[model samples]
Target: MLEIKNIVKQYANHRALDDVSTRVEQGSIFGLLGPNGAGKTSLIRIINQITAPDSGEVFFDGQPLSPDHIGRIGYLPEERGLYKKMEIGEQMLYLAQLKGLSKQEATSRIKHWFEKMEMQSWWHKKVEDLSKGMQQKVQFVATVVHQPDLIILDEPFTGFDPVNVNIIKEEILSLNRNGATIIFSTHRMESVEELCDSIVLINKSKKILDGKVREIKKAYRTNTYRVEHLSHDVQLASVEGLFAIESREDKGENTALTIKIAAGRTINDVLAHLLPIVQIHELKEIIPSIHDIFVQQVTTKASNPLISEQE
Candidate 1:
């Protein structure tokens, strides 16, 4: 639904986005991940047309990005943007109309969302009167009330308890299920792992990684496996060629081991060696989490070495 081609943006001395490019597939949850000052916001701003890219092109739904596509995109920025003095319903009506919604349609959607969010009593309340979480809920309502084709969410889970976070998360999923392509930008790797089908990692104003979540994790796998077995006295130190035990934990009656299979060695080889010595209870390959992958990639490419690994 969205294609960013070699987008470049600069601000005075620093380059916020440097030749960055990625695609957001239609009806899919795409993650835009990075640490502080990693050019994620710059790319997002360029997509929103808040600032023009120094060079390169962006295409929306097969055409060049332009003002006509503005109403088809929904953006919920990390920084809250609400008129604190205005009534919740009134403010939402104005924002919706600004996104090209008619008065009657905007009012109906506002009512539907307020009722869905159990905020019916809050319609007449001013933004200044609500707590931070309540205000976030209102902003979320404003974002999706128009049901745009493309939704861009930045740090969308901020300022909310777990319950409310889940509420908003479910709503995001519901929106995607109904055919909205979502670009979810956040430092929360767990959310990316759970919600994103594909992701692109940006660091130091460049695109570092991009692919399906499963495929990326597969590419990073190192043949490591976790095993839990009933064997206290088992010793594999003498077996040098099959595998290397990375870690071992004792659980009273059982022992858990993390081992990396050596070159030319297979799971069957490790099992063959262990089956006689221990009664295997559980065994599974250890796949790297998105958090681990994020840190590894960013730190590996970082020249500063002190970059914040904000997974």
Candidate 2:
């Protein structure tokens, strides 16, 4: 649904983005990931037309992005903005109208969202009277009331409690199911794992990784496995073909071990030898988490400046 091509942005001597490019598929939740000052906000601003890139282009639905496309996109910026004195319903209706909805249309949509989000009783309350989480819900409703084709959510669950978080998560899934494309940006890697179909990781003003979540995890695999067995003597020394033991801990009657396989051995081969020696309970591959991948990529880039230069 969206394509960012070779976008570059500079401010004085610093480059916020350097020829970064990525695609957002229709009806899919796409993750935009990076550490602080990684140019994530810069790219997001460019996409929203809050700022223009120094060079390159952004395309929406195969055409060059422009002001006319603004109404089709909903943006919830990381910095929350709401009129403190405005009533919940009034504020939402105003924002919806700004997105090009007629007053009657906005009221209808706002009413539906307020009811669906269980905020019907809070409609008359002022923004300042609500809790942080409650205010977040108000902003969320305001963002989607216009039924934008693309929704850009930055740190969407920032102040939400677990219950409300789950509520929003379900709504996001429902939105996707109903044909709204999502570009989710957050520091919470666990959320990415749960919701994103694909992701793009940027660091030091450049795109370092981009692919399907499962494919990226598979490509980053280290041939490590978490094995649980009844015996405690399943040490690295006792296990044949084990290159190294990453960690070991006791879990009730079973001892869990994370071991790296030797170069010439496979996980199945290692398991074959281990199964005979110990009563195996569980064995699973240790897939790297998005947090691990982020750290690994950013740290490696920082340590090797030449690598980023080459890219």
Candidate 3:
């Protein structure tokens, strides 16, 4: 739904983004990931037209993004903004109208969303009176009331309890199922793995990774395997091609061991020695988590700047 091409943004002597490009598919939840100072906020601001790129182009639905597209998009910035003394419903109405919804339309949409989000009793509450999590819910409803084609949420799940987090998560999924394209930006890797179908990783003002979540994890596999078998004497089992034992645990009569496959050998080679003395019950290859991939990639880039030069 959105295409950013060779985007570059800078401020004075510092560069925020450099020749970065990525695609957001229609009806897909795309995760925008990066560590601090990675230019993620700069790129997001460019997409929202809050700022213009020094040299780049953004296309929306195959058309060059223009003023007319503003109403068709919704943005919830990381920083929450609400008038402290204003009534919740009134503030929501004001924000909705700014997104091009009429008073009547805005009221209707607001009412529905408020009730759906279990904020019906909060309409008359003052922004200052509500807790942080309550205020987040109010802002969330205000963002989606206009039902924009593309929704951008940065650090959206911040300051919420787990129950409310799950509630908002379901709502986001429901929106996607109903044909809304979402660009989710957050430091939370678990949420990305659970909700994002694809993602783009940025660091040091450049795009470092982009692909399906499952595929990215598979590509980052460390050839580690977890094996479970009947406990036996350590000396009786021939350990071949075993680099290291990542972990070991005894469960009643069975023992579980996580071992990395040694270089120059595969899982089959590791099994060749253990199968003789131990009756194997379970064996599976270990895939790296999104958090692991994030740290590994960013750390590698920091240590060796030339690693991602191929991009």
Candidate 4:
């Protein structure tokens, strides 16, 4: 539903974004990931039209992004911005109307959201009177009341307790299930693993990785496997084809081992030799986590110019 094409942005002495391009599909949760000062916020601003890129273009729903598209997009910035002195109900109503909802419609939606979020008693309380988490809830309500087609959330779980975080997470997933395209930006790799259908990782003002989460993880696999076997006297410590024995744990009467296979040896090859030595209980591949891939990519880009260019 959204396409960012070779967007470039520069400040006086630094390039914030350099030839970054990625796409977010319709009704999908897309993750925009990067560390601090990695140009993620700069790109988000460009998408929200809070700032223009130095070069390139953004397209929404198969057309060039325009002013009219603003009403179809909902943005919840990393930095919270709310009228501190305004009552919760009043602020949400005003913001919803500004997004093109009629006054009556805004009020009805606000009431429904408040009831759903269990904030009915806090309606008349000013934003300043609420806790950070409470204020965050209010801002979230304001963001989605108009039911925009695209919702861009930056650090959306900030200031939320675990309970409230789960609540918002459920809401975000519900929104996606109801046909909203979501762009989630955060440093939480675990959240990306759980919620994002696909992800784009940016570093040093460039797009480093972009793909379906499962595909990316599978692409980065290192042929690691975890094995559990019923063995009390077996000591196959000098396995020749093993790259490394990552870990060994004693589980009751059996031993569990995580081993990495050397190049050119398959898991079946390893199992063939192990089955004669011990009764195999369970075996599973060790999939790389998103954090592992992020660190590996960033480090590789910084150290290897050829790899970076090829990537």
Candidate 5:
């Protein structure tokens, strides 16, 4: 439930965001992606009302974004902030109240989250006494203790080992499952692929790509497939003009092949030609990862400044 329309932000000679627009569907995990200085942060700040766009508008739940909507939003910035001397539980209570929670309500939520995360023993620990990961958990609790309608996370997985990353990831999914709309911003494309239903790619202060994850991947699909089959007297070289073998590997009695369909040739045509010479075991199309598309989009825009405008 957020819509950003034709946002433009600038500072002196540098334009941070330029005519960028995107929509986040209610209860969906939307990814805000871009490389450094691509205006992702600028757009995020605008959404958080940390700064206003020089032009354009943002709507929260179909209405113009205003101070009243602040309580309904939770933001966890990339730079972690916590009172070093404050006890973990005390800090959480204060932050939650800032989001409009009553003291009693904040305490209840803080206790619930602390128990849920198995960090009940950390309530009395001071922020400076905790490790980076521990402090991160405390900050995360402070952010969501108020149960805001929209949660904005930037580089949220930083400073955690794989196990802790998975822990935080599960919590994010749980929030989404419970009907919280999330705006996830990170450099981790793998996370975006795993967590986001849709995404918008920004580059050089402009929107280069924006769509549902599945549709975006479908649009970038190449006619490539991986084939595995028994190698009983197989002669792949004999089957020419059907597909180009990109890679081939021998797995004992089986052969694995990565092939791209030849011009005017269908996938079934390649399968038809290969089925006779070998016992086909497995076949699947090779889908490009979000990381691949991210790099491609950024690099393409870098080379062609007008690419965003054209799209």
Candidate 6:
């Protein structure tokens, strides 16, 4: 339910976002992916109205982004901070009220969150006494307590241990399930694969890719397959439309082979031609991970000294 349209932002000698555009669907988790200096933060700030873009516009739901939309969005930045002397429950209540909740409502919501996240015991503790990860949990609670229609989280899993990471992940999924749309930004491509329905990858201030996660993975399919069969010994080249035998292993009972399809041919073509000589057993196609696609695409876009380090 957010649309970033041809947005551009410039700071002194650097152009941060350059005509970047993407759409995030309502009630779905959308991933905002980019390496350092890829203008991702610029676009996020514009969406939050923390910084104005030099040109272009953002649409929230069906309307142009406006001050009224502020209460409908929640943002969690990478940096975590809390009032050192403030009690966790008190701070959370204060922040929730600022998001338009009444004191009673804030108190109720904070209690639920504290219980769900298993932080009820820490509610009376001062922020200064909390660990880094604990403070992150507090920040997350404060950010989304009002249940905004759109939630933007940058590096949300940074300080979370694996168990806590899964906790946050489940909470995010729950929010989306309750009709909130999410814009998640992180360096972890695996999380994107798990959480995002769609994603946009920005590199050098450009939208290099945007598509449904499954569709994007399908587009990058290598046409590589793993096959296992009990067969007569045969020449590898005899099969038509088979590019190469990428790997082979001889088990005592059955032989397994990894094969690549020739360009512009279907797996069926290989199977049909090979089934005559070999007793077919199993076949599976290989698909590239989002991380693989991210690295490959961004790497080909630039030759800068630091671009190689981007992923």
**What is the Cα root-mean-square deviation between model 2 and the actual structure?**
2.6
Q: Please, what are the lDDT tens digits per residue for candidate 5 over residues 1-311?
A: 99999999999999999999889999999999999999988998999899999999999999999999999998888888899998888888889999998999988988999999889999889999988888888888888989999999999888888998999999999999999999999999999999999999998898988889998888777789999888776657634677888899899888888998877888999878877777888899999898998999887644333235633
Q: State the TM-score for model 2.
A: 0.92
Candidate 6 lDDT by residue in tens digits, 1-311: 88888888999999898888788998899999989999998888899999999999999887999999999999999887689999888888888988999999999999998998889899889999988899999999988999899999999998789999999999999999999999999999999999999999898887788878998888777788888887465644534555588888886567788888888988888888877877767887878999998998878864323222323
Backbone clash numbers for all candidates listed: 0, 0, 0, 0, 0, 0
TM, every model: 0.95, 0.92, 0.91, 0.94, 0.95, 0.91
Cα RMSDs of all predictions?
3.6, 2.6, 2.6, 2.2, 2.3, 4.0
lDDT (tens digit, per residue) of candidate 3 on 174-249: 9999999999999999999999999988988988888778788877777888888877645233345455787888
Candidate 4 lDDT over 131-176, as tens digits, reads: 9999889888888999999999999999999999999999999999
Candidates 5 and 6 compared: the better one by TM-score is 5
Model 3 poorest ten-residue lDDT run: 302-311
lDDT-best of 2 and 5: 5
Q: Which RMSD does model 4 reach against the true structure?
A: 2.2
The local distance difference test score of each candidate is 0.89, 0.88, 0.87, 0.89, 0.89, 0.86
**Model 5 pairs in collision:** none
At residue 296, give the lDDT of candidate 5. Answer: 93
Clash count (model 4, backbone only): 0
Q: Worst 10-residue stretch by lDDT in candidate 6?
A: 302-311
Clash pairs of candidate 1? none
